[model samples]
Target: MLKTILHYINVNRWRLIKISKNNFLIYCSVFVGLMGGLAAVALKYLVHFMEDLSRNIGAHVPFHFMYIFLPALGILLTILYQHLVNRDQIQKGIGTIIFNIKRNKANMKFNNVYSHLITSSLTVGFGGSSGLEAPIVSTGAAIGSVTGRFFKLTTHQKSLLIAAGASAGIAAVFNSPIAGVLFSLEILLGEISIPTFIPLLIASATGVVVAKILYSRQLFHLATEGWHLQALPFYLLLGLLSGWTAIYISNVAHKLEKGIFKKQNRYVRAVLGGLILGVIILIFPPLLGEGYHYLQEVLNGNINVLQEESLFSTWLQHPLIMAGFIAALVFMKVIAAGITLGSGGNGGTFAPTMFTGAFLGLFVAYAVNLTGWVHLNTSNFIAVGMAGALSGVLHAPLTAIFLIAEITGGYILFIPLMIVSAISYIIARLSNSHNMYWHDLIHEKNVRPDKDYEMLTAIEIRKVVNRKYTAVKRNRPIKELYKLMAETSTNIFAVLDDEKHLQGVVLLDELRKRIVDGTLSATATIEDLMIEPPAVIEYNQSAEDVMDLFDTLDVWQLPVVYHGRFVGFVSKSNMLTEYRKVLIGQHHQPDPFGH
Candidate 1:
């Protein structure tokens, strides 16, 4: 059985770890890379197979009526799968992978390997306007997480393997190994070093090799010879537009994700999303699914005939009309992609972003050509637009440049890619502080990538809490409270109930004022002088959040609560000291303990 094999591997991996940790990680990275590549292959093939199956089914139906229900069916099936199989509810996506990396120490569930593969494939292949890249990335991260667990890897080692698997998945999908490495570093790992780089590079290259062996077709091509110095200004302008477009798409996608999909009934939302998507695709077939075929048509100057076979062919003949239509499609694509995800469908914005950028470029080229002011190479613009838009959306200019150049075989456009990607990245950075995918992580989940801060986030409030503080009974006189504060060498005193439950705090400052006024009385109880604490820290809350509470409340300390009982108080000084220790430890600085 598989359990026997895992047990054998687990026992031997400890022996290997004794030999060398680095060697064990390097060896494990190879297996993670292979698994990532294989997962990518499997997902891509499944998507294609489902696409073909849908096409065959649509052939027999009148007016392709099956298209309306296909996405709904796919989403419902995914929901059904969640109810039946994923009852424990392991979230499936790149976001969950990144979340686990930062919060869970890269501990991922084994089921993620197949969960996203099945759901995302059904979502995209059955007419959902989304990408498969995220699902594959999720699957790959799961593979690495489980593999690391199998070897009992350290937290940092597990994180590196997760990054390696993600890189391998991207490399396999796009056949761009260098971009894959950059993607992991910029978006996932957030740091670069030789130890991380070598493993990621090996995994990425291995992934591309696997892809080449299995599926040798390139994704896109561009005749970059047409890129001239005369087009420099236009490319710059395109970069600005691409960056703004990315910001718009990101904001709209996130807003829709949080707003319209407000945890409503899945069936109702799915129906609404499907109806709107069906209507849009029926009117503009180029906006359907990934729209890669239509992008090729636009690049070839076949926009007028690209979707002429659709039901809305009456307005498709005129070049000006088609240009305006394509421009509108660029914005609508963002909305549809948002809806596809918001309506319980599973997919990513990667392919749809490229689709939007390419058409937006074509539209700009057409509009300028019609003015008879400047002649522009539409194909070159399309390529640059893809890079710029990707940079803007991802806030990762290097990954954008290399991903486009490698996928399109456009080495000649490298300078232009750099130019456009940089411009777009700057504009996007100004417009939005974080990448589209990172909003939930940074804001809601507090999973930032900074190592020192992450270390602080990893520390719990209980670790730094001052549990030796004196607790006075609520009915204790103010004079006795003064004695307790003086004897305890603490400025703060807690008033506790009979059951040791927290009631309030009695500050020495307040007692000093009462004593100085000569108004203190023997009958005045501690509760009379006690004031409710401004902030409370939970036992399991992160030190980072505890620091935020301190900063927000402008207090030196906050009461730590477990249930309703008073555990202790965590002071700002202790939190800061621990934070300094974590920072120093992260940099391998010499400590007093010689650790």
Candidate 2:
């Protein structure tokens, strides 16, 4: 019945497109935004419902012993679902989305639309200690990809819709439409032009509408008395602290995840990671789940919640001891997040990063207050620190700044936010060029978000290879080369050995020069006349790498070899021709409103 309804809608969609393609695209963008927003709303409610249920259950139990096993149980269930129901490996986080756009032609699997929503809900809802934002973004991207496929849209259109969906997801989550659009452009679709902004803006706005109508609760509230000029130096110090802390989180999470995954058995890893995470949460209750509730408390100047379920509640009364406790939460939050994900839980680092930043800011403000030299506005620092850490960790300063400003309604702190965010971003970038989402893709997969690289990635080297060139054995007489060149309308010839290995290339211009100079020798073999190519291209090399060879050597054509055997020649002209086609296709956006 569902399939029949979808088929009917799809058939009518084509008719609508025929009437007006621009209007159809706009309608499609709106639909994608709605779906993305609905998904975000559903995930948030489900996680909160689970948290409430867990709290009720904990109230009945002593010492909250359930904390010791809840995280592990959640992770185990996530693993089981993937192994049983999903039956396919599901890649988590924003990295997968970026990888798909770069190498997969923006074609995400259909299962992704629901798999992440289900798995991440179970993971985080059951206390997996990770954020819902990453899964939400992935789900949104999948929705756009699937919607495009359903309508049989072009790759460029599909990519646009994907970004639109992601933008909607972020907007829906935070009720910050501009930050959503910026997140998509800055973190997902890199190097987009002005023409591409329409769909993103429409989608983000639609998502915000959906969220406002369906979910009325704000994520965070800041009752800031505003910042003073005297606090500028402290904000700068907080920015530096946020930067160093961002680096610490990235490196520590990377190493911890590596260590956890080294264990071959997934169940054992989940149990062990869950036990460690549970222990950490038992001591630092704020580290449990997304930690947003505690973060709100911190923003509200309610620091006493840190000792609610903590083992150190007795000693947390002392100002110095409480400061140390906040500092410990700042560091342990990352470990809990790392364990949750590394142990097979499905979630993201966004919430955890913000959570840590809030605590770090609180700790700094608390310490400064203790010194009696000057008092600081703890709430302002908390809000700004969230932006600072987000900018430093994600390498998205604008998104972080706007997201915080919009969420807290604290535009008055824009200058401080900017100063801190920029400093933290600079400090973080000095040590690591890419954020956590892009680190593996850039270092291990060699995927980059640069326009040229993305375009080259889209064009396959095999499609542009010219195999029409004649191949003459190296031992063949030079006369055979002339005859072959005459029979074929080609300017280049490949000289191969008996084993079909590429020996060298014989250019028509060189042969013509020899003949014109009257220096041609009939007795000469192909090898004697052949000149070595400046470089040889492996058949499986990426187009970007091939372009690099062409630029570095300044050669027009290079011989392509497969397993040491001569295959064909790839010319710089063909590569650029393909690149131009991609460039044109990407920029040729139809007016969505027919204006």
Cα lDDT of candidate 2 equals 0.86
**lDDT per residue (tens digit) for residues 498-572 in model 1:** 887898998888888988897877689888888999987788887777878888889997788898889998999
Q: Which pairs, if any, clash in model 1?
A: none
* Residue pairs with backbone overlap in model 2: none
Candidate 2 lDDT, 1-595, residue by residue in tens: 9999778676866555575656666888899999999999988887878777666766676756878777777888888988899985676778889898888878898888888888887778777889999988998999999888776666778888899999999999999999999999889887557757889889999999999999999998888768999898999999999999999989888766554866368888888888888888888888889988888887888888887977878899999999888898899998899889888888888999999888888888899999999999999999998999999999999999999999999999999999999999999999999898789888888998677888898888789989887888777788887678768888888887789888788899898999899888769888878888989988899998899999999889999988898889899999999999998876464433343
Give one clash count per candidate, in the order shown: 0, 0
Which parts of model 2 have CA positions greater than 4 angstroms off?
A: 1-13, 16-19, 258-261, 473-486, 521-527, 584-595
- For model 1 the local lDDT of residue 486 reads 52
Q: Model 2 — TM-score against the truth?
A: 0.93
